[model samples]
Target: MATLLYGPQHDPIHIEDRALAHLKIVIATKLRRNETFTLSWKHPEAEPGGRSTIWIHPSIPLRFVFDEPEAPQINVRWVEELMHTANSSGGIMLVDEVLDIGEIERQH
Candidate 1:
């Protein structure tokens, strides 16, 4: 699992390393453009066991920490899908990569 630390107080958002790798790309792209988006995800069991959303912006501090030393394989399809959602007014929603990341070698 990987943790996305967005703010100072909120607990880290835990996600699979493969997904986080892809997300890093999507997020960096947006931030590079000075675009802000909301990232929403269902909390892990260790968290509140519900859903959470965080406003992501270029000015805000953020970090991505992976358990593995090296980055995992990134699915281009997943990045496109995530970028699509991030462009929407509703913002980026974390979905199962296996369902959308077609034709890419899944890092499982």
Candidate 2:
């Protein structure tokens, strides 16, 4: 698992290391251009049944931590889908479903 600490008020969002790595890429790209958007995801079972949303801004303090030392292979299709959501007015809402990290690499 990986942890994404956003600001000081919200609890850390736990995500799989693979997804976090790619999310890091997508998020960094937007923030680099000073684009702000909402990121929503289903809360972990421990957090009950609701979803969580955070306003992602360039000014906020954000941290991404990966459990593994090596980075996961980037899934281009997954990233494109995620970016599409991020670009929408509804913003980026992550589904609990995770893509197979190896699946993309094997094709190339």
Evaluate all candidate structures by whole-model CA lDDT and list the values in order: 0.84, 0.84
For residue 33, give model 1's deviation from the true position in Å. Answer: 0.1
Candidate 1 per-residue lDDT, tens place, 1-108, comes to 998887767567798888889889999999999999999988767766689888898877799999999877676777889999999999999877745443534534
The runs of at least 3 residues in candidate 1 whose Cα sits more than 4 Å from the true structure, single-residue gaps closed, are: 98-108
Candidate 2: deviation at residue 92, Å?
Answer: 0.9
- Writing each residue's lDDT as its tens digit, candidate 2 over 27-85 gives 99889999999998887776679887889999999999889999987777778778888
The positional error of residue 30 in candidate 2, measured at the CA in angstroms, is 0.7
Q: After superposition, how far is residue 34 of candidate 2 from its true place, in Å?
A: 0.4
TM-scores across all candidates? 0.84, 0.84
Taking every candidate in turn, the Cα RMSD to the unseen true structure, in Å, is: 2.9, 3.4
Task: State model 2's lDDT.
Answer: 0.84
In model 2, which regions exceed 4 Å deviation?
Answer: 96-108
